[model samples]
Target: MIRKLYDVIVVGAGSMGMSAGYELARRGFKTLLIDAFDPPHPLGSHHGEPRLIRHAYGGGAAYVKMALRADKRWLELEEATGEKLLERSGVLNIADPDVYSYEGRFEDAAVHGVSIESLDAQQIHERWSGVRLPDHFRAMYEPNAGYLYSEKCVAAYKKVALQAGATLLTHTFVTNIKPEKSYVTVSTKDDEFMAAKVILSAGAWFKTLEPFVHLPIRAVRKVVGWFEPSGKSFDAGAFPGFTFGNASGGYYGFPSIGGAGVKIGRHDTGVEWRPGEELEPFGTYPEDEDDLRRVLESFLPGAAGKLLRSAVCKYEFTPDDNFIIDTHPEFSSVLLAGGFSGHGFKFSSVVGEMLADQVELGKWGQDVGLFSARRFAQEDN
Candidate 1:
């Protein structure tokens, strides 16, 4: 069989890869997107219906700019596709004032010119009666922060990519990637393809590329549960997406949209996962549900009525819990984007743009030093 060639090959047609393929094809680059499974499937991280998007980031001021850029990109995609991808239902970041400080989030908001409101416990209670915060806790509210329809976002990007003349091969597993001095070759079981540039956005399966580009990417298993709300007060129109920071970790949830009930998950509850291992059933671990129930009973009692259903997902975590968007240290023709750490779906739009920029300009068109894989290399020295 003859080998196919292209200007760029994106290995992983999920969130970031699909967006990158769209952007590259829009720019008139001959691009190919290959994936192990058809996306919008429950196999990857981008599944679950909704993902939170917030500009006032508590992660760091470094991320606020990216969040802002992502917000614009999401709106642009919505306009292009004529689809409602984002819902501005607002987001509440609540925590005990003494334990965890909202100072970083506040500073990030101020620096990025993001509008936010500081609310004490009583004020939070009065504004949203469904939420029951302790008198000592406080909250930071961002009116523009909300949830993005994750599945819809990926589908939109894939559709636009196909319309722009990009080729997509789903259910095609990439077995190897070999980077040469002039071009990179990608091999599947049946065929081989060459591309002037390559992008690896393989999410949890990124370790499969360890033979070519070894980055410290770890896959972690996580669970999210849906609970039946007691009343309409927890509906999308009345309630907003929320996160409560605690000593053990943080817990977050979405409002009941379209009578689907409330969906909640723990941010810090994940165990190291190896690829190819069987994923246990969602409710197999009783402690998972019990832990979420404890948080709901304490903070948002009205939203936690009955155990509805549950699902499992994986997060690719870096040692620093930040993203990695740099060229492979040994292969300049290949770029990598992984280690989203469960908070990356919202930034897929801008990240795709950044990856395209790296392919064409040899730089990301912005300062992303914080997310560079070189940080780990430096730490070793």
Candidate 2:
């Protein structure tokens, strides 16, 4: 059956889409949040026990402003849900002096006035003596940056969205979107949706949406895993979460949230991937296990006491690895929040607000001019 009309239709109701739906519904709009699965599922990207929520964007300083506002919204959601979604235990970034992570993040802190502390290798060893660190490694500590219960956070938004009169259709895979001058026609296997506006937050499926809107997003499959740290001192407190970058590789992870282990994964392990193909096969990869073992062997052997669990998630990567949150080229009715590149979870809250404005006011107040689809047409990535 075809739905008669909707103010907004959000595809892929995981973190960002659900939050947007919740916001729209709260604003007295008839919103629909559709998903391929019920969510909090293994097939899609927004899983795992927890995710690191760091401020002081290593990506750039412009993101810092957005992140600060987003951080506030996360706190607001936490208050609404009455669930502790974020942990302010802090984030430790370990890298060399010349590396992008250390120096850039340091600059971000200075530029944005975000609280940060730069530490020497000895200082890092002193502050957290539980794990091993290289002698030449420098560290930047952002006290506001910590971890978030990502799946639970999404679930909270979904619950509130339903409460606000938003309709959520689970197991509805959106196959096509055709835009008319008036509205967009969205189709799924079981039903069709007609909405005044549409938002494409379909995560890894961003590439497939290019025909609908020319988004220069490449979906890449990346691995995240938890390790059973043998030493009790290797616990969460003893092991403040971190994002690392070096000439060899960069990675990030949470402390022992599962109570039995420390979780970690390499950021750049994904060579290019095609969706539904290598994005996420039916199960884990043997080479994935070998890769985690290799990383642990190179970095923290104690935390890698056991590969307790492992899985893969796809990151919708833009050429510049930044997000695209703006209207489509030819259609004002279709909005997009694509190419998160493994870092959009933290900004989901404020991103929803921006998208809501795009649907209602015809433009967002924020300076997302950098996220335009036209950027791809230029030479720079």
Count of backbone collisions within predicted model 2: 0
User: Can you tell me which runs of candidate 1 are displaced by over 4 Å?
Assistant: none
List clashing residue pairs in candidate 2.
none
Worst lDDT run of 10 residues, candidate 1, spans 279-288
Taking the tens digit of each residue's C-alpha lDDT, what string does model 2 give over 213-270? 7677777777877778776656766678887777767778777875757777777757
Give a tens-digit lDDT track for model 1, residues 31-145.
9999999987898899878999999986686689889999999999999999999999999999987789888888888877999999999999899988787788999999999
C-alpha lDDT of all candidate models, in order: 0.89, 0.79
What C-alpha RMSD separates each model from the true structure?
1.1, 2.2
Q: How many residue pairs clash in all the candidates, one count each?
A: 0, 0
Cα TM-score per model? 0.98, 0.93
Give the local distance difference test score of model 1.
Answer: 0.89
Best by TM-score: 1
